[model samples]
Each structure stands twice: as structure tokens, then as C-alpha cells.
Target: MRIVITGGLGFIGLALCRRLLEAGHAVRLVDSLSPQIHGALPDVLAPEGAEVLRADVRRLGDHPEALADCDAVYHLAAETGTAQSMYRIEEYTDVNATGTAALLQALARAPRRPRKVVLASSRSVYGEGAYAAEGTGTIVQPGTRSKAQLEAGQWEPRGPRGEMLRPVPTPETLPFAPSSVYAATKAAQELLLLSAAEALGIEPVVFRFQNVYGEGQSLMNPYTGIISIFFNRARQGLEIPLYEDGLESRDFVHVADIVDALVAALQADVPPGLPMNLGSGEPTSVRMLANELLAASGFKASVRVSGQYRVGDIRHCYADLGRARDVLGYKPRVSLAQGLARFCAWAAQQPAYQDRLDAAAEELRRKGLGT
Candidate 1:
């Protein structure tokens, strides 16, 4: 099958390209190679025996040739900074929301449309995620935590009657409650693709991924990927900062597992237009993550929880993965311990990158998104 992957040069995209190519698929990678992810004047380290096209996802309409004769299209390009998205509203919307529109327009102009269009959605769309009232045991999808609540350090979401709530496995059934511009754009991308794909008689598969981390993730991009940022800081003997007392948790799925899920979606008979979550199905707190990563890196850097909190940050969220398991038979194989060790080993060989963590936080602070 002939496949085209947008943002194919990215960390996840490159991994997917390798797998598809190994399976004898004709793969073409389209990416803008943004300097934030790929260093300035990158060497274009794309996989061997695959076609590479330098193009922006928002302008894919102008390059219909990339989509022409494509059997499958994987939409994996987007601006993915949760805190930074609060301030860089236009850039996030233009790249993520408008980018999806352009992809659909390009498909509409294609000589032969693809059978499937898979989107890379996010768990952030389910802000605060699924929670349960402590006594009632009733599942609730809480709305965004207010600024006042965050200011007062009320970290967890509460029930309407002011009852305490506990985080649970967030399912696909939860409605969208985006907390940041980035999350909103991801929701927009999902809706646009799902609705338009049906109209075009194409299969739309959306996977809301949890926190994906592993080797090859961008170490210099401090605006996203907490694992990369933390690892980078630890390697450089810099302090690792944690926000909101460091109890907030995330489901950390490895990149290899993510790639496996993408391959499964292509071959498995997954129901069209139904969103499935791809994750490890286990919650790991930020504090636990910091300890594990620092130990794995063999770096001695102070870990600090400065009572700082970023707007649009969620208290807790992890994937249910029941739908994905039922539909695609997907199960993550890498444990957090193993994945962290692997990541640290690979990152150790790479050059120590400049820690941009402070600069990014200062940008958010100036914009009043962080405190």
C-alpha cells in the first residue's frame, strides 16, 4: 500500500516510517522540519528507502501530488505545547486547526482519495479527565479548574456539591472539554476530519494518545514533552522543577508502543470514525517520574516543587484503553521503568543540548499563564 504521513520527520513520524517501510509499504513523509523539533539546518535524517517531501501541513492543498495515489494518510503534525499554547493562540490554531482543514482540502483534490485518514488526537481534550465523587462513586467528567482554584492550590477537581473527587481512567465516552488552545485545536482537528471523512466516504480513525515518551524525542524543545525536558535538565546537572506539589499524574506510553498501535490501526478492522485511546493504561505521578528519570540518568540534580502552577494544566488524566484493546488488540509492552532506562541510555550518547526550560517558563510567566 502507498502511504503518506504528515510530519513524517518528527520523533513519532520517523518511527512510524521505519515500521511501514519494513512492511514493504510505499511510504512518503511530508514535514516542514520545524527548527524547534529538528535543530537549525537539520541534516534531514529521514529513514532510508522512503520518499521525503518538505512541506507545511497547512499548505498541503497546494501539493496535491503527495496525497495522490495514497492508500492511507496519517495526520501527525501539530503545535503541541500545553502551557505555551495559552499565549501562542494564533500560531497554535493556524498550525493545528487550519492544518487539518488543508489536509482535507488536499484529499478532496486528490486524483484518488485514500481509504483511511488517521488523526493523532490528545487526552488534553478531556480536561481534568474522568473523576468520581468520593462517597457517591458516580463517574463524572469535570470541567476545567478555575483560575481561583489553581491560585489557592486546590489541585484536584471537585464535584458540583463541593465533594472530593478522585481521578479515574478516562474513556472515549467523555465529551470534549479542552483546557488550552492546543487542546482546542486538537479537538477541532478530530471533528473536522471525522465529519469530512464521512462525507468523502473515507474511514476516519482518531487515537487520543497519552503522554508519549521514549528515545528520539526532542530534548531541546522545552515547551512540550516533560520527559525530554526533565531528562535534559538532569543530564546537564540542572535542577528539575515540578509544578503544583508534583502529584499530578500522566499515562506515559512509549513511542514504540505508539508506533505499534498506528500499525495495528492500519491493518485491524477498527470501526471508522470512533475515537480510541492509545496509552499504557497506568497513571504515574510527576514526582515518581522525576525520581525514576533522574536515577536512570545517573545525574545528581535537585528536584524542587516550588508551589508553581501553570494555567491549562490538568490535575490528572490517563487513558482507559478498553476501546483500543477491543478494537485493535492494542496493549503497551514497555513499562515505565524499562522505557525510562532505554530513553536515558540513548540520550546519554547524544550531545548535551542547551536547557531552554527557564526561557520557556519565563515566556509563560510574562504572558500570565504561569505563576
Candidate 2:
């Protein structure tokens, strides 16, 4: 099979590319190597066995050959900064939403379209996720946290009658309630592929990924991936900042587990209709993550609960993996402790990068997206 992966040089994309190559499939990577994720003068080398296409995903129609004769297409290209997206609205929508359109157009124009189109979506589409209303225990999806509510330090999302809610595993049936530009664009990407794949006679598979962290994650991008940002700060003996009293949680799945699911999606017969959640089905608090990373890295950076918050931030959200398990036999094998150890080991050997957390936070604050 010949596979083309947009953003193929990205952290997850590179890992997926290597996995596909090892399976004896021809892999082609289409990536612009945007400076935000790859850094200026990126020193990245193409995966040994794969072909590389240097092109922006928004202009994919101009390079139709990248999609020609491909057995499958994995669309992973996007601008992925939740906080930054609140301000860089146009850039995020253009890259994530419009890029998908370009890919569809290119496929429509292709003499031979790929049979399978797999999209790497995000869990952010379920803003605040499913929660249990206090006392009644009814599962509910809460709305976005208001600025006033956040300013008042009311972190936990409340029910309509102002009842306190407890975070629960979010099932795919939950309706879309994206709170950020990044999440909105991801939802748009899902709709674009899902609605068009059938008309184009292509099978569509969407995976709503959680907080993916592993060895090759970019350490310099302070706006996304808390693990990398926290690790970089800890290595420099700087204090790790925790937002929203550090109790807010996320489902952190390792890149290896994510790759496993992606590979399974390729060979395994998945029912094409609905988007499936890909995660460890567990939630870890931000503070817990900080402590674990510090211990794993043998770093003694102090943690500070800054009470700071981002505008589009969710209180807590994790996946309900029932669909992925039944359909793809998917199971997350790497525990948070084990994955942290692996990440720390790999990150320690790499050349150190500057800690840009302060600058990134300032940028968010300047844009009135963070406090």
C-alpha cells in the first residue's frame, strides 16, 4: 500500500510514518515544516525509507501527485495551539479547516483517489466533556466556562441550575461544543471529511485523540503539549506553573498507543460511520502530571498553582474508549508512569531548547485570552 500523510514530519506523523514503513508499505510525507512546530531552521531528516513532499496543506490541490495512486491518506496537518488559536483565529482556521477543504478538492480532482481517508481529530471538540450533576448523577455536557466564573476562581463546571458537576468519561455520542478556535477547526475538519468521504467513494475514519505525549514531541513549542513544556522547565530548574488550582485533568495517551490505533485502523475493518475516541480512558490532574514528570526526570522544580486560566480551556475531559475497544480491539498499554519515564529518557539526551513558557503566557495575556 502507498500511503500519503500530511504533516508527515510532525511528532505523531513521523511516528506513524515509521510504523507504516516497517509494515512494508510505501510511505510519503507531505509537510511544510512550519516554524511553530518544527522551529526555525529545523534540523529534521526525512525518515530513511519514505518519500518527502515539501508543501503546505492549504495548497495541496496544486500538488495532486502526492495523492495520486495512494492507497490511504492520513490527514494530520493543522495549527494546534489552543491558547494561541484564541488570537490567531485566521491562521488556525485557514490551516486546519481550509486545509481539509484543499485536500478534498485535490482528491476530487485526482484521477485515482485513495480508498481510505483517516483524520486525526482532537478530544477538544467535547468542551468540558461529560459530567455527573451533583446529587442526581445525570451525565451532562456543560457549556464553556465564563470569564466571570473563571475570574471568581470557580473552576469546576456547573449544571444549569448551578449544581456542581463531576467530570466523567466522555462518549462519542456527546454533541460538539468546541470552546476554542483550535477545537472548532478540528470539528470542522471532522465534518468536512465525514460528509465528503462517502460521496467520493472513500472510507472515512476519525480518531479523536487525547493529550498525546511521547519521545519525539516538540519541546520548544510552549503553547501546546504540557508534558514537553513542563519537562523543559524542570530541566532548567524553573518552577512549573499549574493553572486552575492544578486539579483540572486530561487523558494523556502515549504516541505509541496512538500509533497502534492508527495502524489498526488501516488493516482492521472499522465501521465507517462514527468518530471514535482514542485515549487511555483515564484522567490525570495537571498537578499530578507535574509531580510525576519531576520525579521521573529526577528534577526538583517547584510547582506553583498560579490560578491562571486560558479562555477556551476546559475544566476536565477524558475519553470513553468503548467504541475503539469493540471496533478496533484498541487498548492503551503504556501507563502514565511508564510513558513519562520513556519521554524523560529520550528528552534528556536531546540538545536543550529555551524555555518559552513565560513568553507564550504573555502572548495569551496580551491577546486577552489568558489571565
Candidate 3:
């Protein structure tokens, strides 16, 4: 198969490139090399046979000929920061929403369209609407603050009383309550892809990804993976900061598993308009993640509880994965502990990881937090 991967040099994109190349598939990589998340391409993607182009997906219509021959496209390029989106809302909309629309239009005009287009959606689209039930078996809203916040805190509902809130793992059917511009753009792209598929005969597959973490991740990027940030801080014996008492949970999916599910989706003979969750289906709290990393890295570190929560943070957001397993034949093979160990081992050998971590710490220190 011939595959064109947009944002092919990114953390997940590069990993996908390596996997496709190893599978003996012809690979073409298109990336804009945006200053924000650009990193060196992996050795596997540096081969002479691979096609590499410096093109933005937003301008994909200008080069319809470039995507003319590919069998499928894994659209992974986007403005991927949630916190930064609060400030740079327009930029997020332009790149993620408008850029995706431009690519869909290009595909529509292409002489030989790709058979399938897999979009990388996000669990963040659920936003503050995702939560878990408490010991009282009552569902709690994600945004409520409490006075006695433990290291592993819990959620409390904020709305009207006597309303029964059900606690079910968030499926793709859940209504999107995107709190950040980044998430909003993702939700918008998902809708656009589905609508385009229905209206224009394009085959679109949407994977709403959970928290993805693994090798080649930027430890210095404040907006990148939390596990990467914690690993970097723990290696230096710095205080590991926990947001909202460290109990807020997320389903951390490995990059390898993500690629596996994507490949499965691409190979399936299913029709367009299929949306599924790509996740481990297990929730891990920030405190538990920090402990696991400490155990994995042999780092003795003190955790600092900031007791400060982000405005639109989700308390518990994990996928059911039933649809993914049945439709895409996907199952996450790497456990959180195993993934953390592997990542730490790889990170300890890289000077770039340490440098990025130090720079991030200095920036945070200047802001008088997360030292």
C-alpha cells in the first residue's frame, strides 16, 4: 500500500511512518515544519526511497497532484495544544478546522482520490462533561472544587440536584462539549470529514484518541504529554507538580497502539462515516502515573500538590473501546507501567530530553510555579 501521512515528522506521525515503512509499504510524508512542534525525522523515514515534502495541509489544494496516487491518507497534522488554544483560538481554528477543510476539498478535486482517510480526533472534545461516579454511586461533574483535596482527588457535581447522572464510559455517541479551541477544532474536523464522506463519496474514518505518550515526544514542550513532563522532572529530582490533587484521570494510550489501530482501520473494508475511540479503556490518575514513573526510573522525588485545576479540565475521561475492538479489531498491547519504563529508558539516553526539560523548568520557574 502507498500511504501519505500529513505531519509525518511529528511525534505520532514519525512513529506511524516507521511502522508503515517496516511493514514494506511505500510511504510519502508531508509536513510544514512549523516551528512549534518540528523535530528531526527518524532514521527509518530518512531513506532515499521515501517521499518527503515540505507542504502545509492548509494549502493542500494547491498540490492536488501530490495526493493523486496514494492509497490512503493518515491526517495527523494540527495545532495540538489545549492550554495555548485558550489564548490563540484563531490560530487553532485556522490550522485544525480550516486546514482540514482545505485538505478535504483537495481530495474532492483530486483525479485519483485515496480510498480511505483516517482522521486523528481527540478525547479532549468531551471536555468537562466527562466524569466518574463517586463512592455514593452518584455521578460527579468534573469542574467542582473542594476544600479537602487529597493527593488523588475526586469530582463533585455543580448543576441542579435530584437529576440522575449516569456513569458510563464515554463512547463516540457522547455529545461534544469542547472547552478549548483545539478540541473545538477537532470536533469540527470530525464533523467536516463525516459530512464530506457522505456528500462527496470520500471514505473517512475518525479515531477519537485518548492521552497518547511514547518515544520522540517533546519533553520541553509545555503543551506536550504530561508523562513526558513528569519523567523529565523526576530524573532531575525536581518537585513533580500535580494539578487538582493528582486524582484527575486520563486514559493514556501508547503511540504504538495508536498506530496499530490506525493501520487496522485503514485496512478494513468498512464504509465511510465510522468513528471509534482509540484508547486502553483503563483510567490512571496523575498521582498513580507519577508513582509508576518514579518506580520505573528509580527516582526518589517529592510531589507538590498545587491544588489548582485548569478551567476546562476533565476529571475522568476514558474510552469504552468496545466499538474500536469490534470495528477496527484494535486492542492496546502496552500497559501503562511497561510504556513508562520503555519511555524512561529511551529518554535517559537522550541529551535533547534533558535540555528540553531544563528549559521548560526554567520557564516555569520564571512564572513562579512548577519548580
Error of 3 at 192 (Å): 0.8
Backbone N/Cα/C clashes per model: 0, 0, 0
In Å, residue 235's CA in model 2 sits off its true spot by 0.6
lDDT for position 309 in model 1:
92
CA-lDDT, candidates in order: 0.91, 0.93, 0.76
RMSD in order of candidates: 0.9, 0.8, 4.0
| TM-score for candidate 3, residues paired by index | 0.86
- After superposition, the stretches of candidate 2 with alpha carbons farther than 4 Å from their true spots are none
Give the residue spans of candidate 1 off by over 4 A. Answer: none
The all-Cα superposition gives candidate 1 an RMSD in Å to the true structure of 0.9
**Model 2: worst 10 consecutive residues (lDDT sum):** 265-274
Q: Write the per-residue lDDT of candidate 3 for residues 84-195, one digit (tens) a residue.
A: 6756679889999999998888988887878888999998887754444543555444433333332234444443443434445777767777866788899999988988
lDDT of 1 by residue, 193-219 (tens): 988987787899999999999988888
Query: CA shift at 86, candidate 1, in angstroms?
Result: 1.0
TM-score of each: 0.99, 0.99, 0.86
- The superposed Cα distance between candidate 2 and the true structure at residue 323, in angstroms, equals 0.1
Ten residues in a row with the worst lDDT in model 3? 143-152
lDDT of 3 at 229: 81
